[model samples]
Target: MSNSNSTPLMARVTLGRALRRLRDEVNHLTLADVAATLSCDISLISRIELGKRNCSQQHFTKLMDLYGVEESERDRLAELHAATREQRPPWWARYSEVITAEYERFLGFEAAASEVFEYQVGILPGLLQTERYARAVIGAGFASLGPDQIDALVEVREIRQRQRLWDSDQPLSCCYVLTEAALHFQVGGPQAHQEQLQFLLELQERQNVELKVIPYAKGEEGAQIAAFRIFRFADDDVPDVAFGESVAGSLTMDDPRDLRRLHRLFSNLSAAALDPDKSRDLITRIKNKED
Candidate 1:
């Protein structure tokens, strides 16, 4: 069995997709064929292609040769494989006990994303949330977690914001659409909520950030849609990913059909939302009302 962690790493996912595509579209090879060449079981090939199992170096090289991957592409795939074998854990690995494997994967994707389109309801998106607001939200949502665990998760959020949003040399372009109700919801009580709105106003001034709000008057425009985010990577080899979460669990979808649906949903929501200038105005109005 290939030595691989149970948790899916972002590079592994990308590599798997690339390999799968090459198998299906480029090489027109079947699992059985590849397995026979490697003298391994078809299931093993399937798992490696699905990213559930890591591809060994021998198999990787053999597959690349079989696929007739271009020199440049071979170099890229080699780097991805090397990344999968990285000895150092990601920054969020310390909080692993507190966060789900899926969430950890999400942090990796979000960190690497070049752009993010997020639609949120009920509360502000994590990137836009204030520390106190995040604390309250995390505490209430994860009531079973101990105080320390909650604190660790909050710190993870702060680190994510700093690295991805505030401190990055090329900060990811972010487009956020939130329901008006999110602004009105007093998540961390009046003071924290007010601060959160003020922070939103400040973030709106950022060149790479775009904030919009869907007012109640818009009615059902975005009412039925759950919160979700679409992450776009700079690497053309990696496809865009659509992620949604609820109390049940989180889901990550990269199928072209799903991506198209989410893109359409986001486009409609953006159309229905207030423009950035008006969004700032409404947020200011709400903040003043809180005071």
Candidate 2:
């Protein structure tokens, strides 16, 4: 099977899905059959269909010929395949040495997401985190990291902050549900914590950002235990992508069943969360308490 360590959004959206559907419709066309037609290993075919790897133009044209895809459809797919390789690398690619395969892939899609939904338990979401807060979080988790490594992580986080939530003309449409525990957790002492809260208050004023707080009184659910993000693209054909991180590590999901479950849980959590006005009021109260 193919692993999705760093698949791009374009390949995931068009090439992989179209090829998979076409392969499915034909009778008696197994991975073995496709591999034979492409003159490669069966694993290669699997990876191409999973969007974990891209086939050469020759291989792609050959497969289309094998599947007997319509000329018009093949042309569109060929164009998309070309674009996939041509798309510029996301900013995180520069920091690939320090970043995990999972996060690298997350950034690839984050760069393309039109709408983002997030839920957090005990730490601020990366897009909303302040410089000091991000530094503290990274430092605490990677205690052995040197100053240079720490600085790079902070820089990447700041870039993500600007691109995803603060860009004046093209910011992502964001909905965030922060648990009361996360609101109260002090990452970098009272002053730093207060500043982080103040930052969230300011970000909430943006028209594109929706900030919500799920209070302790509202209780918790299983979904609240892990911080996860659901990314929605503008085009309907591009399926929603879910990336989640927890003690066990991170994983990505595009399966409809997983997306539906996460979507439902997000809906319920949103319903339980405090509204924007009230959430800001809560943050203000916490900031004042720190003073």
Return the top candidate by TM-score: 1
Candidate 1 lDDT tens digits, 140-163: 989999999999999999999998
TM-score of candidate 2 on Cα atoms, chains taken together:
0.91
Clash list (residue pairs), candidate 1: none
lDDT of 2 by residue, 1-291 (tens): 011212355455557777877887664488898888777999988878777687788888888888888889888777767766765776687887789877777787787778899988889889888999999999998899999999999999999888667663567889998888898888988889889988898888889989999887886542366888899876555678898887777788988899999999999999998899998998898888877
Model 1 alpha-carbon drift over 4 Å, by segment: 1-8, 41-43, 70-73
> Candidate 2's C-alpha lDDT?
0.81
- In terms of lDDT, which candidate is strongest? 1
Clashes of 2: 0
**TM-score against native, each model:** 0.92, 0.91
